[model samples]
Target: MGESPHAVTSLPTARQAGCPFDPPAELIEARRHGPISGFTHPGGKPGWLITGYDLVRSVLADPRFSSRKELMNVVDFELPPAPPGEFLLMDEPQHGRYRKPLVGKFTARRMRLLTERIEQITTDCLDAMEQAGPPADLVTAFAKPVPAIIICELLGVPYEERGSFQAQIETFLNGETGEEELMAAYTATQQYLAHLVAAKRAHPTDDLLSDLTNSDLTAEELQGIALILLSAGFDTTANTLALGTFALLQNPTQLAALRADPALTDRAVEELLRYLSVAKSFMRTALEDVELGGRTIEAGTTVVLSYNTANRDPERFTDPHVLDLRRQDGGHLAFGHGVHQCLGQQLARIELRVALPALLNRFPTLRLAVPAAEVDLRPEIADIHGVKSLPVAWDA
Candidate 1:
């Protein structure tokens, strides 16, 4: 559904300095200029990118707009037909039905089960990190592993094979360095999950995969949902962990606030997610004729909603660029708003809340191992944006 004649006003290109997926100084500067605007994607595709806080929120909440993943680009990746029964691409009634049963499992109460496991994982990673000496790349040692291990445990993944899974996910997210590698990584992940799910069917465990297998749903449906869980659950949380740490390091006042009152860790995580906008942008195809922010959007046009831009809209947020954890009204669209608001947010919050406070309390002297600006943040590689390497120094 992409041949719509909907005319959106032309705005500047969405290209940031380092990567297309990141929010550069330009986009932030533009957000201050206006709310809803246009931006040419790097490939010269005229994308109706929603930047205004209220406008972005309206698009996500509106049923007239669609979030199907296929209409991204006709010339893009030629993968196999998406497997059936996977509900991620479904809109409206179908999307609602698929998500209804699964939402309960992600509640704060259910997520609390993983708190101890998260701590154990964080401690193990840091313990090994201490053995690595000072000026360590925390991305490899702590930031990366903490959430990976926690997610693995939450989904009942075999922790022993964590290295292989981590490698696959990394290749997929490393947008610039690995295209061929990304496809291979995705295929390997499917095979790995296929084998893992089959085993779970035979011997049911108390994990999400096992639960999905044992559910009354069809086999195909189980596979589709399981694949979504693996892709979204792993990549989003891992990005947030690294990006959130980098954000706190850059803003010591927020870091110290959490260090003082660890109970506010949950709120601080929300603030971090709001401030960093780690997921970047999501694509949508127009399902029918609809106008947004004075632009005539016809049926079947592709539009991109930039969470990074919307999160910092000054109209809805005051001093939008700065990282303010004490903000009471800062309900940023770091997670897309409306029906597609990240289903896994509760799980992500628990993981981040547990890990960040633990790290700060444990490593009191923690600081960046390199200059802040030198820390590379290339977001254009994948659907998610974050740091590849986060270096830090602190005495054990």
Candidate 2:
């Protein structure tokens, strides 16, 4: 195959074999091989993959690295620039303006209201799981639904309409589409939010959707904010539930520790986010041409921030490769750092802090129905690393 039209310069003929991301230990080994790594990404311009924690934080916090794709410092799937829609894709000033007001919704006090809702949703799901018996796919039965329902309630998306929304969210994320398809999904999501906002406008409620509708924000801004809350709020939490369960099941000591004292589960949840680093990475582009760590990034060059790699950087966290539920200062960029840090992070933390303790306490007998080697993992997905399915049984 000839070089892709998108390839600006010669890149490594191919990147690493197997998964570009693997377990924490394996990735530590991969990073030891280099600092700034290069990989041939299908037919696109080769991507620059950063594997260290401090480097990722520096790249993310540095305004010189732009998030604008047309600036083109990095490449993904060899695709062209994604038209602006999601706030996540935009650079700061613009990003900060849009990202500001929403911070009010994520405070510990505001997020505390979600605890009861999340627990109720979790319990209801677990009830259904027990009624169905053993050998269950936890992803579908427990992990996926709890967060979806919670987000729907938060967004005031009609509960009955959630299934279709869930499917569309997955489709938009699959990334196999040309830009048109992705844009359509984004537009469709905006229209849906616009309609929902209209509903809340006429008949407000005590939810984020209502607050968004009634806020002094414009229609487009409201829609963009709501869209992010719905998709990210659901997807990230679902992955955390599934992957965290896996970690607990595999490390009996960790599981037993949490079970023995439910108080420790909060820390376990932090460790899980750091360990799984589910949000993978966000992109950064160069604002002006700059050089660092021996690589020259031109004005508008794109960079991928490796969240997974940062969480495991040995320089930041001792025994970074090992899962320590009690580790303090988790010192991980799992939630990211700097101004663009996740707005919904406190909400996510609340969900896990509620879900895990309730889950392990209720399902003390929970164990994996499949071997570790048999579990399916997907690494190529943009911004998130997730299990395709997680099978578990109540073998107690």
Q: What is the TM-score of candidate 1?
A: 0.88
Please list the residue runs of candidate 1 whose C-alpha ends up more than 4 Å from where it truly belongs after superposition.
Answer: 1-22, 41-44, 72-81
Q: Which stretches of candidate 2 lie above 4 Å from their native place?
A: 1-30, 39-43, 73-85, 174-190
lDDT of 1 by residue, 1-396 (tens): 133233234333344543323366556655655665555554555656676778888888888877665654323353243465556676767677667767888887888877777778878887888787788887788777776776677567787898888788677666665667668888887787777778788998888778777567665566677667766787777778887888888778888887888767767887778877877777676777787777766676667777888877777877776787777776878767787777888778877887788778778999988887677765454677777788889876
**Candidate 1: worst 10 consecutive residues by lDDT?**
1-10
**Model 2 lDDT tens row, 46-80:** 55556678788888788777665555544453445
Clashes of each: 4, 9
Q: Which number leads on TM-score?
A: 1
| Estimated TM-score for each candidate | 0.88, 0.86
lDDT of 1 at 300: 63
| Model 2 residue 329 lDDT score | 67
